[model samples]
Structures are given as C-alpha cells and as structure tokens.
Target: MLSKASTARVVIDLDVPGPAISRHLYGHFAEHLGRCIYGGFYVGEDSELPNEGGIRLDVVEALRALAIPNLRWPGGCFADEYHWQDGIGPKADRPSMVNTHWGNVEENNHFGTHEFLALCELLGAEPYVNGNVGSGTVREMSEWVEYLTRDGDSPMVRLRKANGRDEPWRVPFWGIGNEAWGCGGNQRAEAYADLARQYATFLKDHGDNKLYKIAAGAGDDDLRWTEALLKAVSCLGCGREPKNIFQAISFHYYTVAGTWEHKGSATDFGLDDYYRTIAKAQDIERVIRAHSSLMDAYDPERKIGLVLDEWGTWWDVEPGTNPGFLYQQNAMRDALVASVHFDVFHRHAERLVMANIAQTVNVLQAMLLTDADSGALVRTPTYHVFEMNKGHHDAVSVPVHVIERPEAYAVDDHAMELVSASASVKDGRGLVSLSNLDPEAGLEVILDLRGVEVQGVVGRLLTASSPQAHNTPASLGAVAPVELPVNPASRGTLAVTLPPHSFATVTLTL
Candidate 1:
C-alpha cells in the first residue's frame, strides 16, 4: 500500500436515478447455432431430464440466478435464414430445415417462436428477437412481430390466437437483421441503411408492440459502416433520422487468435495468447469512439443508441466437441474480458444503450454451459464479473480520475492503460470499480475518500490462483471471488494493493 496524498472528496449523484438500468446489457444470446438451443436450453419432450415445456429446467434456474436482463434469440447467422412460421404450431407437423451456417446440422422446427418467448418468461428476461431480413421479406418480418405482439382478428393475429398465445408477449426490442456485412447477406452499408428505414417503418406499425428496431450494422471495429449507416439513415427526414428512425446502432466484435477466417484454438492456449486476445478485446473503445463521433457530428443531441449486439472471446472448440459448437471452457481470461467490456460500456453508457453477449449456453463466450446427458451445468467465470458488477448496473456513472503511477502497454503506434476505474453512487452508497490489466506487478492504489466516510467500507476481489485456472462442472466454484482483509478506515484515505491481472470493487455507504 502507498502513502495517501490528499483526501479527495468522492461525490455520488443519485438524481441520476435513471430507470433501473435494463439488465439486458449484461444479457445473453442464444442461437440455433451449435447446441445453444436444441440440446442446450431445450431438453426433448421425451427426454428423462426435468424440463418445463421441453426447456431444460436446470439451465433455466442457473440463468435465472444471473438475473439475465434480456435474452437475444435465433441469431448470429441463424436469424438470416430463420422463418418464424416454420417454428409455430404442431411440433411433429413442423418441417425440418438445415442450419447452413453453424454445424451444417438439421434443425427441427420444434422449439420455435412460442418456446423461446416461454423460456424468457421462465428466466424472467425480456425478449430481444432478431428478425430475418437477409432471406425473409418485409412482410415476413412484420408478420412475425404481429404474431408475437399483436392481438385481435387479423391473419397474423388469428395465427397467434391459434398458436396458443392469445395475448401479445410485449416483445420490446427487435433487431432489423443480424450482421448484414457477412453471414447476414453482406449488403453494402448504403444499401443496408436504405433497407433499414423501410423495414423499421413496417415493423413499427404493430399495435402496442412499440418495437425498438435495431439496425444491422458494422462488423467488428469498422467505423466506415457506422458512418455510412448513420449518414444514409439520417437522410430519411428531419424528424425521421437519428432521433426517430433507429433506436440503436449495433456493432459486432469477437476477440480471438487471429484473422476473421481462422480463429485459433479456444482451450489450449498460452498466457501470451490470453494477453493478446484481451488486448484486442479492449480495442472496442476505439470503435465506440469512432461511431460516437460520427453520430455526434450529425446529431449532437444523441438520440440514436449504440448497441454491442455480438461480443465475447471466440476460440477453437474444446476436444471431442464439434468446432462449430463453439464449446470452449470458460476461465479467468474470459472473466477479465467480460469485466473490460462492462467497464468500457459504463464509460459509454449514455450512448451504448444495450449489449448482448454472443450466447448463453454451449456457445462462444457463454455465461452458462450445460450437459443434459449428465444433468450437469456450471456458471462460467464470466458469470462472476456480471454478478460482481451488478452493483454498477443502472447506477449513475460517477467520474473517477486516476493520478497515481499509470503504466501503459506499448505497441507500434498505440497504448492502453494498465489501471482502469469507474465509480457510481447508488442508494447513498459510493462504489468504486477497478480493473488492473497488467500481466505482472501488483498496483499500490492510494484511495482518497476525504469528507466521505460516515460508516464502513467493503472490498471484494476476483483474482485467479493461476492465469490458466478454469472452472468445470465438477470445480464450478474454483475461480470464485474473495473478500480481502481491510485495516481500519483511515481518516480520509486508504491504501490498497491490487494483484496483477485482476478486477476488484470497493463500496462505501456514507
């Protein structure tokens, strides 16, 4: 621990009491891709496993605990070819189709629209459905909304009544399409933006749906696509542009070993690989800045939102598992990446509205992995970051300034800080969240809390025994968080030593 400089006053503004932040940013995505749905979230009706409406009960219970804010369904590239109608009605009578993108496996239309929305209900999560635009028509997309959210007597409305849902499910957020740059049809940005206006106009007409249509956007950190989409969509009309047209502008980024095509091994990697992957993961801030700058230039009031719809670490599949399944082990590395993303999002919370990780179960960077055969399930280390950061959700972003020794990672032309922190005050409690990304060297942080101590403080640490340590179904509790011992509260300052490659949080209720 280092010596205290001055007692810096820490202030928290509770008037920033925003609508309890939607937990969806800390949400999960589930696609028919890999075993995310059929074998992951769903257990067959005939199976011996315990299930509610053929959906795995254990997986549901695990996800429910995480308080999954929102669950994105039928996505990645899978949403491109998905037909809402094929998934409704009698299970046996439904036609089976091939999942062209994921595993090249057959997808029985059994666990369709109704089942997905039902699962969201069981987990107490809001439904965020991705509409098919690459292969499906405007009419098709509109009808899906009507079927899921429209009531009364129309063709789509009548179908919803017959499909066992007499009332609308209140599906709030809708993706106009998924990844239009590549697997999602690869349309040029200008063309996609033009199509976005038309699709949003049609889908927005559904009664009481009030669907917040998210336009399909740039892949990874491509700022050009963000600029093109913003410019094109803004030209719709003065009142119809940034402020009214699109509710959110989504960007997708997956941090892996190398290039877009050949992602390296997921499980068996070294520390260098781990550091490099996270270094790349942290580049999302640059992408957000580029997009935000462009949006600010056009609409300084900042009406349109930024959404990180697809994110997380993509690596080679686990041994004895299908590569397409994205079935990799979750470790401290994944947890740190999750922490990095949340910290970045908090910095951009005003503009970065909603974010859903790549997937929930048995997919790339999943929060929960399930094995139905053994009735086994484990919450990934990434899950801990979400649990730890739940305190910051929807809370005001209190400004934090770091003046102590600041180390930087040096590359050819860029550098990122080794110490990062953000603070927020909620319920009259001051919470300081810190992330130390240095691979080595513990940081001696001198916290100045002058004129802010009325009571006590709490500290929780999420540090791994070894960088390579991971949690499996058997050792699910291995890489958990620990409470650090604290000395008596100082008059106005406290000294704390943070271990390398870790994330920690401190709370002060004054």
Candidate 2:
C-alpha cells in the first residue's frame, strides 16, 4: 500500500522582498467560443433568466466576487475571422457568420464589442482586446481601436455614438494577433512579427488611452518562435522612444494528460493519469524560465512584459458536449492544477505580468459552468482555488524555501515533492498557499516563521472526497471551500495538515 502520511517544511522570511504580484496575474480569458459568450455570459436582454443588460447576473456576481482584474476577449482563433464592423451597429442589422474555428455554429454578432465592453464594466475588469491579424487589415483594426477609445468626432466615433455608447472605453491591453504560430495566421515567426508591426503602427492611442500592444508569442516551449518574433520587433530601431512598439509578448500553453487527438476524459482518470497531469502542470516553470531567458537576451532591461495570455488544461470534451465547444468538467485534479500554476506564477511574478486561464466559463478549466437549458450555474473546484488565492493579488512576494520533505511522489521515474507552496505579504499580514499533490496521502506541513511575529493565523481549504469529486448544476456545493482549523503557533512554527488532493490558504497577521 502507498504511504498515507507525508511531511514537508516551509521556511518564510519576512525581510526578503520579491515582486509585487500584479492583480492582473489573476486575469481571465473569454473567447467567442462554446457557450462562453451566448449561453454562459449573455442570455439576451429579453431572456427569462436574471440579467443586467443581457449579461448573466450570477456569472457577473461570481466574477466580481473573485475581483477578476482583467478580461481578454473576442477570440482565441475567432479574432482572425472576426470583423469589427460585423459586431457593431444595431443587433437587427448585424450580420451572422459561421464560427469556423469553433463548433461551426452561426454567430449572430449580437454579443459584439459593445456587449463585451459592457460586461467588463459590469465586472469592473480591464478589457484586453485581440485584434485580427490573420484575415483582417490594418485599417479595420485601427478603426476598431478608434471606435472604442477615441472620443473625437471621427467616422468611427460617430458610429459608436449612433450605437448608443457615447463615451469611449479604455482598452489598455491589445493583442496584435493570437497564436500567430498556428490559429491566428499559421505564419512563421518572422512573417507574423512583420504583420504585427504593420498593424500596431496604426493602432494609435487616443487621449490617455495608451495601448499596450502585445505580440503573438510562442506556443508551449517553442523557443524559436520567441527568438524570431522578439528579434523581428527589435529590428524596428525605435531610436528615441522609451517604449517598444510591442509592449508585451504572449505565450500559450495548455496541459493535456494524453495525446491531443485523444486526451483522456476530464473526470475518468486513475492515479497514473493524475500523476502525469501533475507532472505536466509543473512544466510551466521551465517554459517560463526558458522563454524569460530569451527575453533577457533580446531585451535585457525587461521593457516588454511576458503575457501568458492563454493557458489551462484542455482535456477530452465532456462526454456528450459538442466536441468543438471544448467543454469539460473541472474536478479536484483541475483545482490542484490551478494551485500549482498560481504558485509558479507567483514565484516568477516580476517578468510575468499577466496570465489568463484558457477560458472563464463553460469551457476548458472554467471557473464557472452554466447549464444551457436551466440557466443554473455551478462553481467548479478551480473557481474556489482562485477565490482562496485572491489574497496574493498585488501583494509583495515573501520568499518561501521548502526546507525538507520526508518523501517524493514518484511516477514513471519522475518525482515531485508531495507539497507545493508559495508565500506573499499584503498590507500587514502574510499569505501562504499550499497544495498536496499526493493522491492518497495527506501532508503535514510545519512552517518556520523567521524575522516576523505571528499574531494569529486563519485558514481556508478546498478538498473533496476523491480526485474525481466535482460540481454539477444538480450539486453545486460538492467542491466548495470550508474553514480549516488553524493550529496555534508554537515556538515560531505553525503546523497544518492538508488532506489528499487538496489546496489550502493560511493568512498570518504579523
């Protein structure tokens, strides 16, 4: 039988200061795919469901609860095919087109730029717009930015006013294209970089709305893509300008347990699959390190930020949903994945300015799932993981050193410490987030607090009966967070036991 107990030691020092974890690190992505837009966020202004100007009330409430910092929208691949004109104007006059990249369903163009910006306003999140670089022209993208950000009486501005939105919306983050290595254009790095510059040239800033242009970066560990794109942009020779034309470069990575064609089921996995997924999730650090090294070589001062614009687990489509919809059930495995990734992000918070999980709703590793027919929504285990980790947003990183571990969890000759953790200080307190990756063993962690006085500690944990435990519309509370009793600090050490396949967050008043 496998060992049932694991021991780990964490050492946190208060004097050492690290990067300020950008709240944008907790950002979300909303693609015009699956039910993410229509059934998930938009229920139509006339629908019977509770809504605020066509946006789902429950979904907005949940996102607001997390204090979601930013939202990227309009496409993953759809941005390339999307015409800004098609999504503006009266809903009755708007055109419908086939979403060839996702489901091949007809997109009525109802939930267009206006709807997305309105939703962002509702949730109080920043809007990150991905412009079309594949099938769209410089003029189209330029005018789209003008329509949204320009308050002057230009043609686009007039059109915006005619559509009932008089004032311009501030869109600070803009993508030249998404996945130029694949979906956006299927172009080589050098070629896409050239197109990105051309499009970004005309995407001008209006008033105080300065655009943070993001170049389409590599997919996974493709270092060549990073080198070529950054080199191409560096050749621009912006002699006296303080800012690079591309304010940031994006990277996309998705964790898949099996082959892309036959990724294993979301909820039907055994210990082997579970271990493999954890191993895959751990690759984020290596990917970031490798790509960051390349960024350092080209732009040493780190003027351009690395945006992990798209990420999360992409498993087999949940049993019967439309395969193209990319829908899946998020379970305990997903919660662990979230914890592991957030820890990695926190450690590298300096260079990595922003990241958006693959999707925000009714899709890959979604925080919330909405029933199409019933309009009922369920918060997945991943959602609670975000909730529990929210304290780290905009907080200063408190360096955590894992002092020792009793044993390693090994699978197929690869081993990982049973407990993964990170620490940060916000305001006057300290926040520590931990995850126990061992499927069958609970981890007892003894934290050695040095250079600080701990007045008190409170804990919250998210765990379930099994790795497959998840929430559905019929059972919304299966994977929610509960208060975990905190052990009193004794002689500068605090002890806590993490249940198997669990995540916990402890806040210390210092």
- List TM-score per model, in order: 0.92, 0.97
Residue-by-residue lDDT tens digits, candidate 2, 276-375: 8998898799999999988777777778899999989999998778999999999999999999999999998989999998899998999999988777
The regions of model 2 sitting more than 4 angstroms off are 1-5, 235-243
Candidate 1, overall lDDT? 0.78
lDDT of each: 0.78, 0.89
Worst 10 contiguous positions by lDDT, candidate 2: 235-244
How much lDDT does candidate 2 score?
0.89
lDDT of 1 by residue, 187-281 (tens): 98888888988888888556766878899888877877887778865743354435477788899888775665766666566766766777777
What is the number of backbone collisions in each predicted candidate, taken in the order shown?
2, 0
How many clashes would you count in candidate 2? 0
